[model samples]
Target: MEYFIQQLINGLTLGGIYALIALGYTMVYGIIQLINFAHGEFFAAGGYMGVILLSFLSANGYLATYPWLCLSGAIILSMAYCSLLATGVEKIAYKPLRKSSRLSVLLSALGMSIFIQNGLMLTQGVYDKAYPTIFSQGGFDFGNIKVSYMQIVMLLITILLLILLNLLVFKTRIGKAMRATAQDKTMSSLVGIKSDRIISLTFIIGASLAAAAGIMVGMYYGSVGYTMGFVPGIKAFAAAVLGGIGNITGAMIGGFLIGMIEIFGAGYISSEYKDVFAFIILIGVLYFMPTGIMGENIDDTRV
Candidate 1:
């Protein structure tokens, strides 16, 4: 039982991170029907930005004196940086190709992904950067189960961000516009909503969330690497598809399910085949539920 509980906690932590990244995927797809392959680079950028900010604080003697404050500041700054970066990418690479063929936009996204990854390599190098040790240590124990402070922190932040996102999408006027735009971009524009602006906002929100996940993952794992985003990005994209690509709630559920499956599969079976298990489960679920666990049939009128 204790072993099960331990694995469950680990699953939740991993799932939350995936959920964060998946939200970016689903939101972008919901708005534009295009997968921003460069999305993962935003995550990588955030991790790098966080490490840079945290290290700067430590050098200035601020991180040791006010650890939490420094961390919070780093997260905020990294999120903002990613948001701006996303906005630029959307405007430069995506917006122009919006009216063009889906294949063109997809190719552009792929190009952007390679460009950003190479940019990161050029700037930050291929070496892995280590995170500060201040927040990664210590944890509460329950019998034979152990949970780290970083895990708890990651979970809390993930939950809080998810709640805020739900409220933003469901309760706010902007969310209403977003929904309207998603349902029919032309109609929404005719009704006075700026589809372009809404699409850009969607990218901004998605990138910011990915940035937050990147920072948390870096802190939890004690290091950030330029290549860190690719595999997680692919997994998060799978999670979005599992949950229903355009559905926010579905993405969250899918992310958790994927995370749990990976953790349990690794725990009980061969660790080397954990990823294989995740894909097998995803395939099985999709085979039965073609629209995904929560996905609706996407028609031409949509997005």
Candidate 2:
């Protein structure tokens, strides 16, 4: 029981990371029906940016005396860089293909993904870089179960971001515009909504979320690599599909559920094959619920 509880906590924390990335996938899909495969590269970019910023700060004496400030600075810089990258991708790679066939757009996305990955690999080299630890090292104990401060922080951040995303999607004018655009781009354009702007905004928002997840993963695991985004990106996409592609709330739920399954499967079944656990769940979910847990919003043309 104690082992189960511990694994549960671990699973939830990891799920939080997955949920953050999944939000980006679902949001972009909701708005444009494009998977934005290059998104994984954005995640990698954020991690690398954070590492570089923090490393520079540590070495230059700008943050030598203030460790906490360095950490905060790294996070801010990473988020900003990633947000810009996301917007740039929308402008350069996706915008031109917006009117093209879905297959063309998808292929373009794939090309962008490869381009970014190889670009990073060439620039940063194909080596695993060390990530700095921000949170204090300690765990709270409950009977035989233990939860780390990192886990608690991750959970809080995930919940807070989820709430913020929900508000942005459902309560704001931009949110309404996004929904309208998703439902019918032509109608949205006719109503004076700039579909292009909305699409760019969606990409920006999604990229930023993925960036945050990258930073969190770095802090949690104390390391990152150029290829770091590959597996997580795939898993997040699976989560998006499992929860219902293009559904915000569904993505969140699916991410957490996937995380839980992976962690528990590792703990109870075999740590060696933990990664396969998410795919297994994904397959299972698709087998039974093709439209995902939330079901497809057929009337909402966005997905």
Candidate 3:
């Protein structure tokens, strides 16, 4: 029982990370109908940015003196860097092909992904960067189960972000415009909503979320690599699809489910096949409930 509880806690924390990355996938797909394959590269870029920022702080002795502030600064700077990179990618690679065939856009996205990955490798070098041991010391324990303060912090951050995102999409006028554009871009444009601008904002927000997720994962693991985003990105895509691609709520549920499945399967079954559970769930979800938990259709997805 205690072991089960421990796995549950671990699952939720992992799920939160997956959920954050999945939001980027779902939001971009919901708005544009184009899967931004380069989105994962954005995650990698953010991790690298965080590493650089943290390294700078550590070199200057500020990381030791003001740990939280340094962490916050790293997150902000990394997010900003990724957001700008995504924006540029959108403007350069995707914007011109907005009216092109779906296959063309998909090819472009893949091409962009390749470019980003190689660029990161060439610039940052192919190496694993370790985070400074800022939160390595303290936590609370229960029975035979141990939980870290960082896990609690990650959980709270995920919950807060989810709530704010829900309110943003459901309450704001811009959100309504986003929904409107998602339903019918041409019609939304006719109704005086700027579809282009809405789409750009969607990319920006999604990229920012991805970057934030990248920072959290780096902090939790205490290390990151240029290739780190690929597996997690694939898992996040699976989570979005499992919950219902394009459905925000479904993506969140799917993320948690994936996280739990992976952790518990590893705990009770075999650790070597831990990564297989998320894909199995994805296949199960796809084979059984095609529309996802709450999805309507491809074109009618909400923010």
Give the winner by lDDT: 1
Native RMSD of candidate 3 (Å): 1.3
- Candidate order, lDDT descending: 1, 3, 2
Question: What residue runs in model 1 are displaced by over 4 Å at the alpha carbon?
Answer: 300-303
Question: Can you give the lDDT of residue 130 in candidate 1?
Answer: 94
**Tens digit per residue, CA lDDT, model 3, 1-303:** 998999999999999988988888899889888888898888888888888899889999999999988887888888888889988999999999999998899899999988998999889888888877786557799878989988988898889888988888889999899989888889999999999999988898888888888888888889888888888888888888888889899889988998999999999999899888768877777877887766776556776
Roughly what TM-score does model 1 have, to 2 decimal places?
A: 0.98
Give Cα-based local distance difference scores for all models.
0.93, 0.84, 0.87
Task: Give the clashing residue pairs of candidate 1, or none.
Answer: none
TM per prediction: 0.98, 0.93, 0.96
Looking at model 1, how many pairs of residues clash? 0
Q: Rank the candidates by TM-score, best first.
A: 1, 3, 2
Give candidate 2's error at residue 105 in angstroms. Answer: 0.8
Candidate 3 regions with alpha-carbon error over 4 angstroms: none
* Model 1 lDDT, full chain set: 0.93
Error of 2 at 274 (Å): 3.0
Measured by TM-score, the strongest candidate is: 1
Tens-digit lDDT track for model 1 on 81-172?
Answer: 99999999999999999889999999999999999989999999989999989999999988889999999999999999999999999999
